[model samples]
Target chain A: MSDPTVVPWPRPVSAARPESVLTVDDILVRFQTRDASVTAVDRMTFDVRHGEFISVIGPSGCGKSTLFNVIGGLITPTSGLVTVAGEPIRGPHPAIGMVFQEESTFPWRTVLDNVAFPLEVRGVSRRVRLEKARDVVAMVGLTGFEGHYPSELSGGMRQRVSIARTLASEPKILLMDEPFAALDEQTRLLLGDKVLQIQQTLKQTTLLITHSITEAVQLSDRVVVMSYRPGRLKRIVDIDLPHPRTSEIMTSDAFGHYVAEIWGDLRDEASRGMAEAEASRGART
Target chain B: MSISRADHAPALVGAATLLGLFALLELAIRAGLVDRYVVPPPSDVVASFARIVTEEDIPHRFAQTALEGLGAAVLIALVGIPAGLLLYRHMVLRVAVQSWVAALAAAPLVLAYPLFLVIFGRSAMTIVMMGFISGVAPVTLKTLEGLSATRRVLIDVGRSLKLTPAQQFRLVLLPAAVPTIFVGLRLGLVFALINIVGLEFLINFGGLGQLINELAERYDLAGTYAAIAFVVLVSVLFFLALERTERWLRPGR
Candidate 1:
């Protein structure tokens, strides 16, 4: 079922542009489980431009997260290629920073320490890392909670710490997988605005995978709608909105138009995904 | 900070219960409800303890046993921890050593005491050897477990940061494995103590266990009971000290 809040847009046929920062050429990922070989991502292809915030919206099993993983070099693709800045991504690159969906902040570490982790791993001096970590934490508006461990922080706060950690690494490319999805609606919206603001200020090239249409519309320059199971990119809707976007923009006419258009593109894919999920559930039962 | 009486209650109750049990046993022996020869009265045990403290040359024996145990523990940790890390770093070595180490760990060190005696003789050497054999397994196992269990994400973080293998081990693997290694060390110490005492008793080596054996042979019930109690107290104290040390050393605990 499609969300009733979607406002449809005039369909555009060609939206592809040049000057790509990240290019995924026919990437395929197969998981070798105990019983079966499950294809998570199937020959998916797309390009993200430099300094562009691209949000990938897909059904539950559409391999958006897997794509992010492959991009981050956490997992290797079974077949095909992924290139960043014209170089094949064989393993995790320092230039690419990842913020996971689940709060990945180290529970034993304080917010500042967690942010400093990437720098610490690089053998950067403690004082410099701490200073940079402080700057990033303040950038995420988590200035006062620098000394608080992840366990002491709320989920939204923890996510902010994760973002700060990623930013501390100073990676040109950022890959985030539903970073704000675990947060409450109000917190999600607030964090979403902060993230957009930071990305705008830094001009970071980001690939965000989220199911929230409003989130994608508010933050991303282009929203890539994906189909489930053997996931493929269906369409890329460009949001020509200016940066430093706020919660108010979420209520704008352009925002509504983008949401409706992306929802329309995702409608059939979402139903197919739901049916596949139900059948799989039945099989398991 | 304000102190609470409730916080101290469990400890007080525990101490009182132990004293009460000792008093009950002493009364039973005094009343002829229990055999006085087999089970010494609390007063007699106390007197034996005082004799060990003031009159008998027990301090020398205590120092000897402590030195042997500490030396064995140090040697075991130094040798075993690195060996375990070597296995963790090399898959082929790990596969080759897995079954052998498992078998060695499972086999009782008591069964090997006679072999140690033949090789090292019925001296402190045999006791130390026994202690080393008993303690080494836990340290190796714990080190291996800790090294292998390091988070893949952390490793990736290290790789992304372009850290050398040595640097990665130093910064990430060492800190991550410390808690697990400490657990192994604690278990190894317990095993070493048990083995040391058992070997000393079996081989007539001079330690508290040897004292217990000597007292038992001459039918010195009070002395034997006193020695046994001393051994229990030492073991408890050793473990408590170790627990405190571990708590202090553990980062962010």
Candidate 2:
């Protein structure tokens, strides 16, 4: 079978970096309900070295999203800290960009305006923002869609617009929350390759949250597996694979071995989490 | 399936049905199957309509009612939309005022006319106040609902961009709130019309409703019917105007 997720562009080489771009240090998050406080993330710690692409894989409700929210400074951790470029993440910082699972291009804005939103907010001149937005849109292969609204575009196209919007800001770290989970499997693979190609070109530090083991293996230099709710770190596996990774890598022996290892670690935690959730529902009834 | 001429078939049928009803009413009166004194025949009604258009004080009454309604709509849009936005931004205030707002929305503004009359005393002010009271609640409620209904993902995207509070409100919240706010404005316009006409009738104020009352009291049944038809035509025209305005404002429509 032909490889589905291969892009035509040549991957750019990265320079050696000594320091970490992002660090999550022993973070804990708790949500207060009327009846009781629920822990979402507990004592989780991780780091992404400069120019590295990391994937986080866990079952649904494993607090991976909460971790992303904390890292992006949308929500504060009840305890512990996160720092980007050695600065404590006090709140939403300009250095980190985010793409959500749901494609959220503004319905009222044309693709170009949507992409240029961050620059417009920062008081950049209209001419400068438009020029930068056009470059990003072209990079995402959406040059002809500049004047189209989000509603006029397909799901895959809309997500591409969102990626362009994120890139227009030129942030060092890109945090994605299951950004392809909503797309069809084929579109997911194609966009996944496009994203990898973009990352190779820009060398931005990226953290991706996903549930698919294959996706984690395909994209990451390292994959961090987390346990179920009140989620704790389970294991971190280094792919140590060659750069400009391709779909052919998925069929390799080393890739199969890592997938099996991660599955073994996750299987019991997945069942336990499911049973706990069901029990909680039953108790409510 | 491509939408073409077939898509407009329903609207064409509806318009034809309305025209048929008018014809049937006119024929029934002409055939003396219905009393002309009670239901003035369509020809006589049309003639009366022409007379009102050419000679009667109908134009002045229409202008008066329209001015009051437009003024009230502006006031409601200004006060209610902002109040709703403020409530959306402040959780404690929302919780505190939600029930009160609901009660105000549900209460009949017509019943408050006596109170307004005491304050403003049976003038254009009284009519405008009635319209304002009737119009404000829906705009406020709809604006609040729209603001709250903005998707979390969009807000997350805005946060990631490090947008200031004002920037977020302008870029994300305002556009998100627009369609719902337009719904509110549409509802408010209807309410304003209803209240303005009701106040004119109740207080003997100078508007189309007052003209209807005067003609009815003088036993000029044709004139009264003509005045009522005029009111209906104005309302239909107003709604069409609003529909066009909404389509113009909606991006990519």
Best by TM-score: 2
List, residue by residue over B1-253, the lDDT tens digit for candidate 1. 2366788888989999989999999889889999987788988988888876555467776776777788788888898899889989889999998778867777787888889988998889889888889888888988999889887766665665567889888767876677888888888888888888888788888988888788889888888888878777667776787777666654344
Best by lDDT: 2
Model 2 lDDT vs. the true structure?
0.86
CA deviation > 4 Å runs, candidate 1 = A1-19, A31-38, A252-254, B1-17, B23-34, B86-100
Candidate 1 per-residue lDDT over residues A100-139, each given as its tens digit: 8866666556789889988887679999999999999999
Candidate 1 clashing pairs, residues 3+ apart or interchain: A7-A260
- What is the CAPRI rating of model 2's predicted complex? medium
lDDT at B161 for candidate 2? 79
- What TM-score does the predicted chain A of each candidate obtain versus native chain A? 0.91, 0.92
- Please report, in order, the local distance difference test score of every candidate based on alpha carbons: 0.83, 0.86
